[model samples]
Target: MTRRIVEILKKGQPEETITIQGWVRTKREQKGFAFIEVNDGSSMSGLQAILNADLPDYETILKNLNTGASVEVEGILAPSPGKGQRIELQASSVKVYGDADPNTYPLQKKRHSFEFLRTIAHLRSRTNTLGAVMRVRNACATAIHKFFQDKGFIWVHTPIITANDCEGAGELFTVTNLDLNNTPKKEDKSAIDFEQDFFGRRAYLTVSGQLQAEVMAMAFQNVYTFGPTFRAENSNTSRHLAEFWMVEPEMAFCDIVGDRDLAEEFLKYIFKYVLETCPEDMEFFNKRIDNSVLATADNIINNEFERISYTEAIDLLVKSNKKFEFPVEWGLDLQSEHERYLAEELFKKPVIVTDYPVGIKAFYMRLNDDNKTVAAMDVLAPKIGEIIGGSQREERLDVLETRMKDLDIPPEELWWYLDLRRYGTVPHAGFGLGFERVVQFMTGMANIRDVIPFPRAPLSAEF
Candidate 1:
């Protein structure tokens, strides 16, 4: 049986026969023997295999064992005489499945820029940085499921295609089956007749799953949605993606206080879990990628996140005596720079800012007693600004109806949502977290595109 490199590295005894199937990362030929490093994508470090001249078909096998080639090697584990690695594989036999030409392969034995890696995303995962990123990303995802499941939170599968504009941002990607070349038009030939298209009405790729999560929470009491969300915004920044994954968890009979507690606990749990699960990868990131990687993780795991009201945050920003490109005011939304300053510079830890202005938040956020601000909260982290955004939902029927009307949102389109409050309303709250943003934070990667396997962004969807 073929053994994983990670398991062998951890528990394989010396002189034990083993078989490893993976792609060749590098090869160094000598007068009497050859050395090749093979990675199975199970860990950051690859297994170094030594092949002697007396091995069967040595020249033929050597010809095919270039970088990026796939092969299966039967070897005996032995203590390594070289530095860095603890053990090395003494190969008795080798079988090559495919050959990669060293001259044409995009990934050489040297460092490549993230921009060039983005272009070759198909093969970037084989590199050290991307591979480490992917490992950390997987650890994060597993931690998410484990954390939610441990608390009796049901994994709710929300729809990717939704009709309602959850954020009211108007950055939706319309989903229509109507022929663009010869679309069905209205009687006056003004707008495309969406009624004649699929779904019998206009629909869009969901920008968020918060509303749908609320519906499930009403039934399940506690539920979470982890799925893909899309936005048609033309943002070309490192922080924005046209298509990304979001984690939204809604809980019935919960208020803003409970929401804040859960968000803080959730973040701490994920950080601890990832560090425990992927120490080697985390160490690699700390030593090579960003020197502060381990320190940031330690800070999050050990410290208590600071909590402040949005009003107080605004006041602090105003009194800081620091110049900001965007003006800090009470009613205006906080910019990334402002968030970073509060979390990275001032607090030096994760900061939870709550009770945002109603005009700046979504219509579903519970209107505060003052009627000016909503019970919304944002969890801002160092380096990355807003990692999680959530709010206590408006459960009062009259208030929800009035807020929807004030925002000019069509009541008919969200009839089901209004029905939740009209029939059996309960105080509930939830938050939406960008999965990619969290991965980027954990790895200290400069670009959001580098964290995810295949990133979909403006004018770039090759893979």
Candidate 2:
């Protein structure tokens, strides 16, 4: 059986014969023997194989074992006299499945920029940085499932295509099957008739699964939705993406306080899990990518997050004596700079700000007794402004209806959602965490595009 490079590096002893199948990372021709580094994508480091000149077809195999070549080596393990790794492979036979021309391959020995690596997304995974990132990403995903499942939260799969714009931002990608060359129009011709489209009405790629997750939460009591979400926003910043993954957990009989507790615990759990599971990778990120990577993780795992009200947060910002680019006002939303200052400078840790103004929040947030603010909360980390946003849902039928009507959200379209309030409604709450954002935050990767494998952005969807 073929042994993974990670296993061999960790536990393989001398004189144990094994075969490793992977792409060659680098090759060095010595006086008597040639050394080639092999990686199978199982870990951050690769295994070094020593090929003697006396072996049959040694010259041909050495010639074929370029940096990007695919090969299988059956060798006996031996303790390396080298400085970095523990063991090295003494190969008896080397078979080259495919050869990569050294002149043509883009990934050479030297360091390449992340911007250039993104152009060749198909092959960038072989790099040390990208490889480490993917490993940490996988660890985070596993940790999420394990955390939720251990807490008895059901993993709910919500629909990808939905008619309701949950955010009410009007940024939605329409889904249709009608041909544009000859479209079906109404008698007035002001708009195309969506009645002839697929599903017999206008449809869109879902911007969020929160509403559907709420539906499932009503039945299951505690449910979480982890799936892809779409957005049609024309943003070209380091933060926005046309397609991304979201983790939303909804619970019945829960209020804003319960929601805040769960969000804090969830983040702490994920960070701790990643640190424990991928220590080497996490260390690499700390030493190489960003110096504060490990410190941030330690801050999250050790310290209790500071909690304050949104009104209080605004007041602190105003008295901070710092000149911010955006105005620090009561009604305006906090920008990234403001959030980073609050977490990085003021508290020096994570902060949970609650009770936001109702105008800035969604219509479903529970209205406070003051009628000017809602029972909403945002968990702001040191680097990232708002990591998680949630609110206690409006359970009162009369209040929800009035809020919907005030916002011009037609009541007929969400009749099913309204039905939940009409029958057996309880105070519920949930929050959404961007999967890529968490990975980027953990890995200290600057751009959000580097965390996701295939990033769909504005007019850029190449492999």
Candidate 3:
């Protein structure tokens, strides 16, 4: 049986015969023997194997065992003389499955810029940085499931194709099956007739699954949707992605304060879980990627997130006398710069800003008694501004309908959603956490594109 490098590295005893399969990360040839480092994507550190001159097909195998080559080695584990690792493999037999031409391989034995690595997305995971990122990403995902499952939250799968624009942003990616070469037109011949489309009406890749999650939450009491969401906005920034994953958890009979508490606990749980599960990868990120990675994780895990109302945050920002690009006001939405100032500069920790102006927040958010603001909240992390956005949903049918009418959203289109309030509506709350943004925050990766495996952005969807 082939042993995973992680398991072997953690518990394998010396002088045990085993076989390992992985891609060669580095190779150093000598007159009597050769040394090769192999990684199987199981851990941050690869297994270092020493290939002797008397191994089968030694000369030819040595030539083929370049970086990026696939190989299987039968070896006996022993104490390493190297300083970095505790164990090494002494190979008795080696088989080279495939060879990577050093002349043409994009990933050499040196550092490459993130931009260049993105171009070779198919091969970039072999590099140390990307490899560590992928492992951490996996750990984060597993921790998400574990966190929710431990609390008896049902894992709900929401639809990818939705008819209503949940965010009301008008940045939806339309889903249709009409041939544009011979399209169906309206009577005026100006617009394509969506009546003849596949779904018999306009459909789109879901921007947010909170609505569907709300439906399930009403039924199950607690539920979450972790799935891909899309937006058609042409944002070419380090923080935006056309396609990404979201974690949204909805709870029935919960209020704004309960929602805020859940978000804080959820974030702390994720940070602690990832730190414990992927210490090596996290340490690599701290030393090489960003020096603040470890410290930030420690802060999140140990500290209680600071909380303030949106009005109070604005007051603080104003009192600090910091000149922001976008002016801070009561009715205006908070920009990234303002959020960073509140979380990173003023608070020096994660800040939960609540009770945003109703005019700026979603129509579904529960309106406060003040008649001007809604029970909406945003969890702003130190580096990644707004990490999670959530609100206590409006459960009163009359108020929800009025809010929808005020926002000019068609109430008839969301008949099923309205039905939930019409029948057995209970106060419910949830938040949407961007999966990539959390990974980027945890690893201190400079670019959001680097955190996701295949990033879809404006004019850039190569893989």
What is each predicted model's overall lDDT from 0 to 1? 0.93, 0.91, 0.92
Top lDDT hit:
1
lDDT (Cα, tens digit) per residue for candidate 2, span 297-384: 9999888899999999999999998999999999899899999999999999999999999999899999999998999999988776
**CA deviation > 4 Å runs, candidate 3:** none
Per-residue lDDT of model 3, residues 224-251, tens digit only: 9999999999998888899999999999
Per-residue lDDT, model 1, residue 332, is 97
Candidate 2 residue 272 Cα shift, in angstroms, is 0.8
Candidate 1 local Cα displacement, residue 62, angstroms: 0.8
lDDT of 1 by residue, 148-236 (tens): 99999999999998877656754999998888999999999999989998898888998888888999999999999999999899998
Q: Assess candidate 3 and give its lDDT.
A: 0.92
Clash tally for model 2: 0
Please give the RMSD to the true structure for each candidate, in Å.
Answer: 1.0, 1.1, 1.1
Q: How well does candidate 3 score on lDDT at residue 194?
A: 95
Residue 89 of model 3, lDDT score: 96
